[model samples]
Each structure stands twice: as structure tokens, then as C-alpha cells.
Target chain A: MGSGSGVSCAVTLNTSLTPEQRALYQDVGQINHLLDSARTIALVGLSSDRQKASFFVAGYLKDEGYRIVPVNPKADIILGEKVYPDVASIPFPVDIVDIFRPAQEIDGIVDQAIARKEKGIDSPAIWMQLRLVNLAAAERSLAAGLTTIVDKCVKMEHGRYRGGLHFAGMNTEIISARKRKR
Target chain B: MTHRPGPRKFGFETRMVHAGHVPDAHTGSRAVPIHLTTSYVFDSPEYAAQLFELKQYGNIYTRISNPTTAVLEERLASLEGATGALVVSSGMAAQFVALMTLLSPGDEVVASSHLYGGTVTQLKQTLLKLSIKVTLVDPHNDAAWEQAITKKTRALYGETIGNPRGSVLDLEKLSRLANVHKIPLIVDNTFATPYLCRPIEWGATIVLHSATKFIGGHGSAIAGVILDSGNFDFSRFPAIAAPSPSYHNLRFFDTFGHYGFLMKARAETVRDVGACVSPMNSFLILQGLETLSLRMDRHVGNAQQIARYLEQHEQVAWVSYAGLPSHADHALAQKYLPKGPGAVFSFGLKGEGAEVREDGKKFIESLQLFSHLANVGDVRSLVIHPASTTHQQLTEEELAACGVGPEMIRLSIGLENVEDLLWDLDQAFHALSRSIRA
Candidate 1:
């Protein structure tokens, strides 16, 4: 297990350590494994305004091969995907639920995810958009035996982990070469 | 010390902080004061007549010009190495004024295929509705522009560093192409402010900025500025040079001499459209411009660093930044934007397969530090997933044409410490790793 300084997994461990924890651990593990296997994303908060961070990051992630799912109340559909008001409303089983809403609204979203989890719908993970504060809810989901990640940007992570950082438009091949060795 | 030239010849930094501004003439105030008044009273009827009839040039009305805004225009012009500039309400207005001044009904404009969504809509939809024809060309291909030109084409338009994709245009080639055809080359330098790349220096006759982005730095103000190089010989383009009914048979070239284009744009297009920059916004933009050179350096540095970090990550699929040597336009970027390609870049992620629970979208949803908003150019870092957001209106084929794919992610690096940014990224990937393990 990685060090849990910024995030605490204890709250999760205390609530569900039975077969469910192992099952969830396995489930999240498989989801990440599948992400390694596939390439496409559907971001919900993708906006068109350049002033909006969602606009650029979504574009970045799309450039990375993740089929983006832009979900916004104002936009009918984005990146060719029919944007839904909520995850449960989506017709398809998405691998991830990237939330770009405010921190306060995350609890209800987590509740929706929980409802879906109860209905035998197995989502791989619940990824919150950056700065989407919901530490308690993230812990609750983790306790429920689901994989939870927070406080990070999906685009930056993919770039750093997938060896895409070599394309910084400068001579940084040596750094990436070293990183690959790790 | 006695023999050394003062801050005038120091460097870009010193000039940005001090150029075109001195203590207030009346109060001896060292700082540029925000002159909020709407109109400057004339001393007498003769003075007002002189100001109105162009016998002299001074503040007549805030609608026409303001002292605070003048400082900003002068500073921007100096930075861009241009002879004159006009500050406007927003970058969009600046573009509108530029177009309105140069193009009449039935005239044509040759523009790049890869442009801001708003700009594309304006040219294809709004401008078309106005009876102005627009020819779209893939800026990547030099020949496409050559083939699109017509006798009615008045100007060639493009962005210095294309938005979203970060594709760098070869300004020298486009400028040469325009020159050969006797048309003006207008560039939107919003992405790459003069601090990074000055289009005017690269043969662009006119340059426009959103100023709302890095220029404002804080994302608090919406404003724009147009800089005229005053290098183009308008006489060669008789239509623009020979003005008539719009301004009382006054031939711009014959009267205004060097600052003809800028003067005409302000006097006519902006006057009618009423897209003048508000004094408050102008003051905000001026404050932002003072630190532009400094902020831009850090923005580029951090972006380069973060882009490199993301490109090497195991979960990433592809990366696109002109600063990246492997990028298709790296050579062009080197030639045009040698001072470091603008801060924004794009990348993609490896999505999960059916057996895995979280898909690529899930991975994005999992991140924590990055803010998922619709705006960019803030002091803080920003991120977005494009296929589903900014370009949602476009179809798959359209997205592909714009170089956007399913897993693509765009990142606009901020001025934060690079290490902290990387650490935040590292945690997100670790979560991804953990999720995959289950």
C-alpha cells in the first residue's frame, strides 16, 4: 500500500474489512488494469470556454486517446457523446465517473454511485475532478470497498505515468528514459 | 554607473515595469493612476474643434481614448515593436474592429482551420451572415493558403499558438504568402503574448490579443488590444488606402500617414460598434500587463516541466506540445517561438478494458489537485477533457480533423512549484495503479 499521509485509508478499512474489502480491492485493481488495457474517456464538465480549465484539460485527455464524455447541463452533447445529467442517467456503464462539480455537491453524487453499486452495477472507480472536495465521501466510498482517488488532474496523471511527458517540446527524453526504468 | 544607460536599455523586465510611463504630470505620482472619468473637458471651443478636426491629438472623450488605457496601449505597442495600438473591450472586439476596418461587404478573409471555437463560429457563421466570405485553410499546409486566396481576399488570419491543440504556425511563411498577394496578415497572439512571440516582428501587419488570458494573468478582466506594425504600404491595397463615404472622403493613406490602419479602426469600426474598453477593465489589464513578462516566463517554464512530467508517465498515451522536440511542428515552433512555446499542451491516457472497472474517463474523474473549469490563464494550473467538453459540438470526424481523440487531455500549467505539481500528479496515478490492481 502507498503511504497515506495526504489521504487516510483507515476510515475505509474500519468500515469494511470483510470479503467486501477484498472484493472491492480486487475490483479497483481490475479497473486500473483495464484502463491500462483500453484507451478512451468521457469527461462530464468539458466546457468550450478557453478561460475554463475543463476546456483545455479535456482536450489534453482526448489527445491522449480517452474518448471524452462531456457532461454539462447547458451542452446537449460533447465530443459526440450524449451528455447525461448524472451517471445513473447514462445508458452505458462508464469505467470512471469524473466529477467536475463543486466540493459540496459530491456527497449526493457519491450517494448516486452507491445506489448504482447496490443495483449490482460494478463501476471500476470513482474519480473526482481536481479540487472537488469530498474527503468524507471519498472515505465512505473507500469504506464501501470502492477505489477512490482525489486532488489530482486526470490529464496530468496520464501524461506523467504513460511516458507522454517526453513530448514537452524540449530535450527531456533523458528524464523520461530514467522514469521508464523505474 | 554614471556612464551606464538607465533602465531604458536594461531589459524586457525593466522596460515592462517602467516604459512609456513616468510620474504624473500634475501630482508627481510615480504609479499610473486609474483615470476613471468618462470625458476630458476642453479648455475652449477652439481647442475642442482642433481635437475633433484632427488638427491635434489629445484626449477628447473616454469613448475615443483615456490616459490610463493609453499607457497600456503604448506599453503593449512597445513590447510588440509596433508603432501604434488600440485597446478594446475584448479580444473578440479587437478582431471585429480589425476585420471591419479592412473588409467590406462581399470581401473575403482567409483563415486557419485550427482556431478558437468562438473565432471559428464568428468567421463561419456570423461573418457569413454579414455577406462576408471566409475561406478556411489548414495552416499546417503552406499550399492550402496559396490555393484559397482570391482577388477579394483582404487579410490572412491565424493564431500564433493555436488554442487547445497548441499547434505552432509558421508566421514567416504566412506573412510572406500574404505579402506576395498584397494582403495584410493579421495574427491573434492571445496564446503567445509578445513576451513569448511577437507576430509583428515576424512580418505580421497586425496583432491582436485576448488580454483576458496571461495578459490579465488573474482571469479577472476581459479585454483586448490591437497593435499595428505600420510597416505595410496601404497604397498597394488601394481599397483600404482610399477611404471615402465612411469618413468624409478622407483617404487614410493620404492623411494619417503611418498610423492609418489603427486610426481608421478606432475612428470608424470601434466608434460605431461601441466596443470600447471600459476604464476599469483597462486598469485591471494594465496592472496584469506590468507582470506579464515575469508571469509568462514562469508559465512557460512550468508548462514545459509539467508537460515533460506527464509525457513520461506510464498511464499516458500521447503528448502534444510544440516545445516537445518530437512534435510535428517543433521545427516551426523553434523558428517562430524560440522563447519557449506557450504554456498550454495536450495529452491522452490509456483507458481500461472491459474486464477493468474504471474507464479512461474514470481515471480523469479520480484526480484531485487540478481544477476542472471552463477558463484558462489563471495563476493556478488547469485541466480539461476535450472530446466531451470544448469540442462536444463537433462530430467524431470533426474531432479527428481538429486532432482531438477519445483519451486526449489538455493541461494549462500554472506558476506553482513544479515539484508540488508532480507530486499531486504522482498521487493520482498511484490511485489509478491501485484501482487497476483490484
Candidate 2:
């Protein structure tokens, strides 16, 4: 309901932010670039039910031309993709690891992402879901030279990037600051 | 615009005005606009489908969510420190939805015997028709409460300041029992409001309100809200925690997490029952909430003075106001409602038999300031002969048990000058005496 809050209020907590790191996440254009370049997204803790936010966001990302890799112990498959138990279990390289888990679970997921990178897997950027934050996880990911995003949704970021949210009457903080690139 | 975020961490008074609200980006309206449309237009077919599927949180139909009502819901939840809330058609509807959300046909509810008569009827009769058994225990008896629960019990329910009786709930003892049993403790704080007491702070899992009362201070609207503390695990509750066939095996707790109960109540219960509050009533309730603290303060002050005045009067036999030192519940009220014992109270007239009823009616009719009606918590003073009006259907034993005596006259103290209220009652007692002589 806020101008800049967009679809998610995206309150970044737990993960300590330096002035520079805070600026990076707040910069809408930089976020837009990240979404544009991503090819595949791994949604950890994704559920099979359509009502779940993770399931919805994964479907949206797949529709937007990004391959969705479902990662959850409960599901055998989701969004027509084979489900993996964790980040390290994914058969192919994941460009982005978007976490849909709670704040408490983010640290473990981040740790797995770090391990995957250390074991010569692709260094996928980490994106934490809305309202979920872990400062230690963000710090560890950033220390390993990975692009870390916290307390934001990948679907909403893409929606804002394409100027597709205004038609839905969502608070598109996009048009004003970006000078109507659409 | 580049300031530190999370202004939401502000104080209650500030949040009451600003929470769940923002200037409309399109219209720049500072006030939350009442979205009168019954349905919202989706950006795409996929978007509409997603909303219907509960894949995302967005307004699809007014019955499920409206921007205006959503703001009121958020503001109330914020004021009560609840994780989420749902606003419905009336105070009764709010109670129904919240209870119905947790209850199934075979489940049970353990409730306090001292409660609003309508609520008593709701639990005893209506819930029975649904096959949901309710066990009522004397609120003062700790052992009775302990014995009422069975494996089938789904929730524990009571009122903060009971109707007619004005007895204060033992929140600590009640919370302890609820915790031991692992069932959610629910309190209807319609009388106390959050200004006086927050049931959540005392470990209540759910706090409900008949927004028609103090929440809407003015008698212009009928509304109710159910606020969840998000503390209940709901892990064992199949309706909330397990897969549902209604929405493709979707579990509300798995999806919404912390505010799972509220989300399920709004989406499933409200959608099926069709008891959502209109955007118009939602707007009016929000208006009342803005000055709630101010109105409640005056209401409490007037009530304390009026209760004391009636206590010393020769015509008055006894008063049932928790704020009074003579009240049986005064100690409990002091602990839970230290701000004051609220505005509504009952007092018995002197003399006995059928003549007491006549005198009670005459006293209420003779009053110029107090409006004689069934409603309470009005900005203007209201009077009711509960044994004859609100409790008319109840037998003598039932009425007496609820503290509605034959000589009882209920008064809802308002914001009128205390002198005028007392003077009005003073003259009414004279009228009762004059009628007796006639």
C-alpha cells in the first residue's frame, strides 16, 4: 500500500547492512538488471499447492522465461520441474537461488549455496523472500563475492522492471524514479 | 524520501492513525479511500487466476478483501499487537467466523458462563446445530474450567469485561489452563478495548471485538473484528494445519504461516458465509477508532461517577459496576482494567416483587438524558431494563445467574457532562416515587 513498498513491504532484518549494501538493495535499476540476466531460479522450500506464495512466484518466474527448479523435501515435483531436496541436490547449475523459507531456515540454505559454489558449482545470486532475513547468511554470501538480495521477491522485482504492475493498481514506485523507461 | 524505513515501529496512537495506511500513489489521497467496487479488475487472466488460487495476496472480490476494509483490519491488528485480523458484518459475525474457523462439527469449545447473552445463545444453540458442543464453566471456578476441557476441545473463550455482569476475566489463570491444554485462548475485549487492556499481552491467542461497541464509539455502524496473536501453532488442527480439498489440498498454515488463522477465516470462512463488512461501514469504524482513547476516557470517568452516585442513593439497592469498591469483581478489574472498569453497568432499584419491574421501567422512561434502547457504548447515554428487554426471553433463574435482577436497570455512561447525567437520574428516582404515590 506504500509508494515504494510495491507488492511486498520487504523489511530487511537480521542481516546487518552497511551504507553501501543498503544502497545496493534499494537501487531499483540494479535489481532490474539482476532479473534481466537470470536464466534459471531455484526456489528453496517451494510447496506444491498453488495457494503458497512460493508456488505462485515460481510459476510467475517460469512464465517470464526463467527455468524454475523446485527445492523442497516434501515435494517430488513442482511447476513441471523435478524437485531437489536442497540447493546442492540440483542437477544443473542454478543462476539464482530464491529462498521462500522462513528467516530461521535462510542461514542453512545460504550455507548450502556457499558449499555449492565452493565445490565448483555456478555461483548463483541469493534472493531472500519477502519478510525473511538472516544477516549472517547475507554477509557470508557477500563475502564469497556473490550478489545477495534479502527480503524481496523475484516475481515482484520483475513485475516492477517491466512496468507491468501499474495496470494492476499496485503501488508502482517504478515510473516516478526511473523516468518512464517503459 | 530517503529516510530510515520501518516507521511502523512507532507508538500505538501514531499507528492507529497511520498503520495499514499510505497516501494513494495514483490519487494522492491521505485518507484511505473507500473502494466501493464489488470486484477488482486483474492485470491479466493469469493474475486473476493467481489471486483466486491464493497464490498471491490481492483483492479479487469485496467479500474476501477490499482496500478500505483491509486498512481497518491492519490498523486494529496493529493496535492490539496481533499478527493479522479480519473484519466482518457485525460483532456477532466476527465471533462466528473466528470460532467457526477453528471448529468443526465434532469439535468442542470451553467457554466462560459470564458472557453476552447473545454469545451464550450462539454457543449453546447455534453452535449446537452445527454439532459443535460448548461446555460453559462458572468463570470464577478454576477447577470447573479445568474439568470442562476434553480431547475434543478446540478453543477456550471468554469476555474481558462481561456483559450485564461486568465481571473481569482472570486472564492469567485462563491463559495458564489454555497453555496446559494447548488449545487457543480467545477473549472478546469489546468492553475493555485495547486502550484499557490487550488480551494478547496476557497470552490470549485470539482477541475478538464487537466493533459496534467501543471500537466504533459512535452508534453509526455495526461491525466486528477477529485478531490473531499468531501464537497458536495450529499444527494439530486439521482444518487449518492439514491439506484442504476446498483449495486443492492447500494448508492455510503452510501458506500464510504466522497469520494463517486470519487468512483462512477471511478467505474460506468469510467467502463461504458471506459476512464481510462493507467498505462504507469499515470507513465509519476507522473514524470511530481514531478518537477511541479520548471517548473511552470520558466514558470511564462518567461511569465511575454515576456508579458511586447510584450506590449512595436511597432508591438504589445495589450496583454491579466493577469500578465500584463494593463490586465483587473490583479486585480483578483493578488488575486487568486499571485504566477503568468501562462504561456499561447495572444497578438494582429498591423494593421487591412485580413492583420492582414497574419502577425500573418508570425510572428509565423518566430519564431525559439516557436513551432507552438495547444498545450500549454509544457516544450518548443509554438505559435499558435488561430483565425486561435484552434478557426478556431468559427465565428468572437464567436472568438472575447472569446478574440481571428483577430491579436491574442497565446504563451505558457516555461523554455527557457528569452533572447532567446524575441530575437526569436524580429526577428519574423522584418520578418513580411520584408514580408509587399515584
Candidate 3:
């Protein structure tokens, strides 16, 4: 198995998780694969306010050499990237659609993602930000053969595997005894 | 054949080697690079403002964080099972920064009487200058510890294995006391080095290490680290939960959650104190950490043999190593430090007052292999007379309280061959006897 981020995906799961939950939310290997494979990410609900988590994560992703498309109806540009009102409106191919909207709003956004795929646009993976889980919509996206992530922070995952989150005293949960491979 | 999922938790040995670093993305260098630069470039004016305002996490200057030092912090944190760690200039700086961040002028601390001489001075003398009073108590007296906790008391402090005398602390009991009193239990785990024991696993909220010791394995680097378990609820603790005018009313606990204390220590305390560890020292310490377990196993094995040999000698009055069955804290040692209570300990010589002190000096000088030095945790064995050197600043009563006596000769066992070390000790004992006869 290839871990493009150089972080081991082996993880102990909480006993409370079901088989479906294990394959979906807890597959760190898949998360690593997506992070490594995706080059262009479209961040839905990207805010113009600097203090917002969405804005902070978008800026971090942009800095890490990822092409970020800001999808906000209110903004023209964010973090020096052009803003599109929705995922479908973006002219270029998008590998991931990261949603920072509320839990209730995930279905509408997933609908837009599905419509884009049906129209022969790129089959973009759906990512719901931290604490924004929509299992029903996630199931629909999964049925349409699109990778889906829920209730996770994209920036934190990126930082966790790439050896960045520990700087602020956060636990990265990576335990290996060998020096990181070259 | 059924597919089996690999074990989720990596072993300690594996983590020691690999936990804190990844290959350099640009150059593919497997080893940790010494980032010798003082400052990092900002992408834009707006980005610079965000970093300065603590709205984002990125390198601003080496004083706060360096790529090399960050690996040391993360690696140590991984070993200790702590949420995060901060590296400082020296062991004293780690303790000072931790206390300064956790306390105000009127706050108080309850610490163990059994501690390194330098730590005792920092607690009793220096902290007093800041109006923070520290009351030393018998670590064995559970009642004394609880009685010392007043409303003004902010932390309970102790060492995992006490210096010189080798008294093992009852971390679980003290942690429970701290929990009831709503204070944090801060432990100096310099002696145990997370290989033998992790104070955080028992209940400590914070752990401090003089990485100058076993963490470095070799005596090449002088550095320290402070680790936070992130288990303490700082919601009511004003030092962390309250807003700070220094950073335009930023509340650490509210802003960073579990990472609040260390982030404040690094951004505010270390930034102002300028007590930052250099990237070169970090690289050296990292090299030492790679072979920490290997060195410690030999150190412990050699120490057990030496302590046993010393106990049976006719000129030796008593041995204070917790690994010995006759030791007072031997049971506690088994509980806290199952891999033996470290290699450094103290022993008394057979004689009365003035004669015994003379014998100690003679014995240390006669040893061919053991170097006479003040520092411990070196790869080479070291000997010191505590009453005349390390603990000489303390008065008689203070010296008695700390279990240091005129006849006390402290030994920091090294990774030398046990047979060679025993032969050296045998010759030193004979030399002392011959001197007394003359």
C-alpha cells in the first residue's frame, strides 16, 4: 500500500464503530490516498472573513500547493483564488468539493456535486468539514461512485499526516519508531 | 486466508526512531535537517498579519519555532503520550517557563523535598522573588501533600525518580489529590526518560524533562522539554482561560483548546525570555534519542550490578538505589519504574562524620574509570560528593531535608562493561582503606 503523505494509515478504531462506519469514516488509508491524489479542491462555503475556519483552511490548502476554488455567493475572491457561486460554475476540473456549510445544508451541496457528475463534468469527491455529517447525502454520493468524507477537518488531516499539526501542541496520533523514509 | 488489520498502535522502539519527522519534501533527505535560519518569509502582507495575530500556524521566527526543534518536540510528545511538547534552552528553563505560564504572583506550589539541588533553588529562592511560594513536603507523607494544598496552590510537583537518593514517587496517589483539589500535577521525568515510565500515563497533567540527560543519551546537548497531557480542564483556570491584553485579548483556552498552555508558553513566555533551543542542539539531541533505549538498557543493567556490589562491600555503609530489595522505595519503584529506578543514586561510606567525608573524596578520586563530575546521564560513569559540591549551597537542616549527608557519594552509572566498572570500584574501595591506615 502506498502512503503518498509518508504517514502510516494503520490505526486502532473505537469499539463503538460499525462495519459500514469503519469502511467510511475510519479508513485513514483512503483519506491519505485522496489527499495525495487530489490537486485541485473546490471549497464550498469559503468565507471572506479571515477569522472563519473555512477561510483559514482554504488559505492553508492554497499554501500547500493545492489549487483551491472558493465557492461563495457573497465573495468575488478569497485567499487570492477566484470565487465561484457553486461547484458546477467553476470552469476547470475539480478533484474534491470540500463543504464548510452547516449539516442541514449538505444535501443541497451534494445535489450540485451529483449533477456535475451526471453532466459529464469531473467526478469530484465530497468532503464535509468538521462536525458537519450528512450520512443520507453521503450514501447518495457513494452510490454515484464518488469518494465521500464526513465530519472531518481537511486542514487538520493534511497537517496531521504531513507533520504540521503538532506545532501547536495538537496530538497527531502517528506512532512509528523508525525515522521517516526518504 | 482472511485479511488481518495491522496493529494500530506502534511500539515504543518504533516511535523512538520515526515519530517526529518525515522525509524532506523538496530534497528527499531522510535525516532531520538543521534549519539554521532565524526567520521565515511571509507570502503576503495579509498573511504576515494573520501569523502575527495567531490566526494561523506557520513559522515566524526561530525563537518561537524551528523545523528541527519542532521534530524533537513532536517525538518526545509521542514517546510520553502527551498532546504536545515545547523545547527550551535548558532543563531549568523548561521548569521556569512551565511555572511562569501556569501561575500568577500570589499563587503557591507544593513540591517534593527530594529533587535536584538546582530545582530546589529555583522553587524556594527564585520563585519567591516572583511572590510564588513553594512548600517542600515529604513525598512519602500522603497526608502532608493534601494538607499543603490551599486555595492559592496552583500545582503539585515532584520527580518520577528523586535525585541522588532514588526515591520513587507515588504518581497515582498525588494525581488523585491534584484532581480533588482542582490543580495540575507537574512531574519532572528527567530520570525515567519515558522509556522506564510515562508520568502522563498515570495521571500527570504536565511532564518536564532535562533532555540534557538520558533523552540525549550522550552528554553532547544541553536542552529541555515540557509536555502537556491535555487532560486538565483549564476552563476555570484564569491563567489559561482568561483573555490576555498582551495579545489583544486572546483567550488561550478558548482559542486553541487543549493546546492552550504550551502555545502561550511558546508565544508569550519563550518569545520574551529568549530561552529558545538552537537547531544544532536539537539535531544533536535527536541523534541521541535514536539510541536512547539501547543506552538505557545497558545503563540500568550495569547500575544493578554496581549497586549490588557496593551493598556487599565492607566499607559501604548503605546503598540508596530503588532497584535494591532493601531500599525503602523498592516496592514503589516496581510500581512506577518496572525497568529499574534509573542508574543514578547515592550511597554512604563506613566511618564517622569528618572521616567519612574524607573517604568519599578519596574513593571518587581513586576510581580509574568513573570521571569526577557534577553532571549526570552521561555515557561515561560519573562520581560526585553532593554535600561538598551539588548540594553545598543548602544549610545543614536543608541538606538533611533533601537526604544529602557529608558521607554521601553520588554515582551516575554509565554504559561501561559491568565487569570493568566493578573492578574499578573494587580498586577505589581498597585505595580508601589504605589511605585511612596511613
Name the regions of candidate 3 deviating beyond 4 angstroms.
A1-6, A10-24, A33-153, A166-182, B1-8
lDDT of 1 by residue, A21-80 (tens): 334432333433545554545465666553244654665555445776676767776645
lDDT against true structure, model 1: 0.70
| Candidate 2: stretches off by over 4 Å | A1-41, A47-53, A60-96, A100-109, A115-182, B1-8
Stretch of 10 with least lDDT, candidate 3 chain A = A8-17
Worst 10 residues of 1 chain B by lDDT: B4-13
TM-score of chain A of 3: 0.88
For residue B115, give model 3's deviation from the true position in Å. Answer: 0.7
The better-scoring model by TM-score among 2 and 3 is: 3
Write down the lDDT of every candidate, Cα atoms only.
Answer: 0.70, 0.80, 0.86
lDDT tens digits by residue: candidate 3, B1-438: 997864267778877987777555457667888899899998888778868877667789999998899889988988898878999999999999999999999999999999999999999999999999999999999989988989999999999999879999999999999999999999999998999999998999999999999999788899999999887888899998888778777777755556779889999999988899998999999999989888889889999999999999988999999999999999999999998899999899988799788889899889999999888999999999999999888778778888999889999999888899999999998898899889
lDDT for position B405 in model 3:
91
Better candidate by lDDT, 1 or 3: 3
Ranking by lDDT: 3, 2, 1
List model 2 lDDT by residue over A64-165, tens digit each.
678889999988878778999989888788889999888888888888888888988889999987668787888889898778887666766675445333
Q: What is the lDDT of residue B17 in candidate 1?
A: 66
Clash counts for the predictions, in order: 104, 1, 7
**Candidate 3 local lDDT, A1-182, one digit each (tens):** 12233445454321233556656765677788888899999999998876456776787888777999999999897888889998778887899999988878889999988988998888999998755778889889989988998766788778776666755545576764334333
